[model samples]
Target: MDPQNYPSMDQYNYSNNGGNNNNSGYRNQAPQQHQQQQPQQGGGYPPQYNQGYQPQQQQQQYNPNQQYSPEQQGIGMQQRGGSGNEFLISSISSNPLAQVGFSYGQSLFNDGKQYVDSNIGKYFSFSSLKSYFNVNTSYVFNKIKLIIFPFPQKTWKRRIYRVGDVDSYLPPRDDINAPDLYIPLMAFVTYYLLYGFQLGMGREFSPDKLGTAISKGIVGWLIEIGIFRLGSFFSNSYSIPIYDMIAYSGYKYVLMVITIISSILTGGYISFFVKIYLVACLGVFILKTLRVVMVSDNSANSHHDMHQQHEGSAMRNYFVFGVAMLQCVILFFFN
Candidate 1:
């Protein structure tokens, strides 16, 4: 309390406080002076220099190299976003129906892209459909490159497989004109005979009526599908004929029918599909002749223009169905 009276106020605690205050002033001044002298290294902005222009630290760019889990693979070929053909391991699509349809399209049946090559079996297969210059498989492969035409054939093994890559992947074949004449003939015969027997046994065997209905159904279906353009949308992805799409739809029905009806019978679905298959085969042989005869018949009457795509499809279908009907007629008489 009597500090002023002490022998040396300068040596007391009061003096020590004064010296400590001076030391702090010196320590703070050094940092400010050093900062003013040193120039910030990086270009453009400076680090925390002017508040208006706070030098921003350069942000490190995003590293794609960072490991990603399976879930982080981003959008892949398997995910059905834009197109339905993608495949994902365990993802439910926003559009469930599209997802299912796309899945079915991509995986099984190779998305309807396989087995359309007319030349795989030399004379019997697709070779007869068109006249090739060389008939050599090598030349055919080059011309039929998947880029120009996308077909749905398989790898060397012919076993079903996935094709995620594009460089090597070929688009599905548009025309599958391969014909198996012998088997088709037999199949055509069996189907009609069987159909005739079934109707006859049912006590409602009217050849004329049944023939008309079946012919109309098949012809109508083909005519409708044959005329479809698929526009530019489907054109980029596939070269499939509208006829096949329509025919396949009907054919799928036929195949299903074959599978179901034939199942109970001896051959299962094979017999039914085989009949149309035979018809397809027979069409191979009879196409030229049918065209000449049928065209001439049309020309004689001049019923309608033959150049119309729909008319052509109808004509083709008519021929195809007539052959099927002929087989059925034989069954009506005999079976």
Candidate 2:
């Protein structure tokens, strides 16, 4: 026989049997673990080949929707710290000293009952009252802003006065030099004349009726507008360091109460219109006066700084008060 016929030693095609592994019982093990199963230092059935057993590169975990950067997180923190409720920068200076003083003063006034304390230092007690007066007076002042006559803030100037200031949220003046002096004067004149005529004619007025009546028409309109102006002027923009602002504001409120009382006496409280407002006026005046007397010039300065913040708030108040005083005089003589 030839050598070709005798060479049958390589008849099997051993290629891991193409690794068609239907049995995971052995394939589930790691390749390294499978090597441990070999016969000790001798021969064994050849180890099974597993191409899928290589170590997989470890994957990093991530949530697609939760991604964020360090810069964005820092910005979020800063925004929470910069909110404005704790910092009303427009009302007072940013200086730490000023801020401290304002806060102290605000706290001092926030507690009103401390003023009657006899055991405490009188200055502290006085400070308490001063705070009380400052706040209450500001409220009263707002209630009577319109009595500061003549140069009233032109609410509907486009339709009514035809005059506006430079920073006007309203229309400009029709004639700059005219001053619109007589509008207030004439309206007030009509008011007093009607009052006297009704009184002289012995026409008794019910307080409620008169109050209700005066609340109508151009006259009532003017009164409402005046009171409205007075109230708005007492806002955060108001600054009067020397106590002049509050003092002036209180005086105007008093005067306005007097005017409305006089008018309501003619028309509203029905039967006792005069008596009601008369009592109200005297009561408010005396109470305010007592508070004023209790406070020193220093205490009065509590609201003084706001006057300087904007010259216009107090200036306008002063000018209008002058007109009211003039109208008051006019009403006094004729009525």
Candidate 3:
């Protein structure tokens, strides 16, 4: 082998060292190239980290002048409005005046409900009175005819029904002889309207006048109720229900309405003779209707002593006559 062609020991060691240095340089350059390529791939960060960080930058740099669609604006407005409403409700709940008003209204409602349930509810059994309004068209037509001419109805006694060993009168729907408040209330309203109409025809109609007429009619009705109650008390007769008495007394209003209607049709004024004839019809109706209430049943009278029954019967007849006579005065006043 030739030593000069290969190299001396010193030169050989230098060449070996240069070779190791060049290999290390290539290894170091490989890592530097990978680090440089990282920036081009994903901005020198992990993909997930970049993804998270970009959203934050976008939020911070968001445009304030961006316009939204109507639906989006509405949704945003509703959210704000809902918050505002909550704030307003809180403010109202804390206000003393609002609290006071609420409490006052609640108290008034409770008091009114209690008053109606206590005083008025006791006398008026609304459940039972519902039957009065159960009348059909035929019943109403026949009832009007009977009221105008009651002398033809031979049967004045109200139908009796037995229920669990107790006897109860049939409702007006089932029996024509039964008393009802529906006709009376309707007739009373009709009379008022007729009266108002008459006044208008005469060029004397006024709200105050109409109000006064209604008040007078109501007062008259109450007076009749008082008379009937007193008579029942004094005569020691078989007392009917107070509502029945109200119904009986209210029948006069039907006649009064008819009379006023006749007057309006004839000459727009009630004549004295026409008033007298109506009074006679109303008196006869009242007398016949009250016979069922004022007179004691034989079965009921059997419970009383002879003297007591006889005395009661005599007083009842007197009271009934007096009540019938009162119709003339009431009819005349209405006219």
Question: Could you say which candidate leads in TM-score?
Answer: 3
Candidate 3, residues 1-335, lDDT tens digits: the string is 77658878999899999999999999999999999887566656677766655434334567889878898869978999999999999999999999999999999999998898799888666778787777877777888888888878898888889999998888787888887888999999988998999999999999999999899889978989888888888887545777888887888787888778777888434555677777888888888887766664434666879988778888888888898888767777856
Cα lDDT for residue 231, model 2?
40
Question: Model 3, 314: alpha-carbon shift in Å?
Answer: 1.0
Q: Going through the candidates in order, what is the number of backbone clashes in each?
A: 19, 28, 0
1 versus 3: better lDDT goes to: 3
> What are the runs in model 2 whose C-alpha is more than 4 Å off?
1-56, 69-252, 261-335
Summarize candidate 2's per-residue lDDT along 113-180 as a digit string, tens digits. 45546445532334423332322333334333333332333431112333454321111123211112
Looking at candidate 1, the ten consecutive residues that score lowest on lDDT are 174-183
True-structure RMSD, every candidate: 24.6, 22.9, 12.0
Measured with C-alpha atoms, the lDDT of residue 270 in candidate 1 is 66
lDDT values for all models: 0.43, 0.41, 0.81
Model 1 vs truth, CA RMSD: 24.6
Better of 1 and 3 by TM-score: 3
Model 1 misplacement above 4 A:
1-193, 227-238, 241-257, 263-335
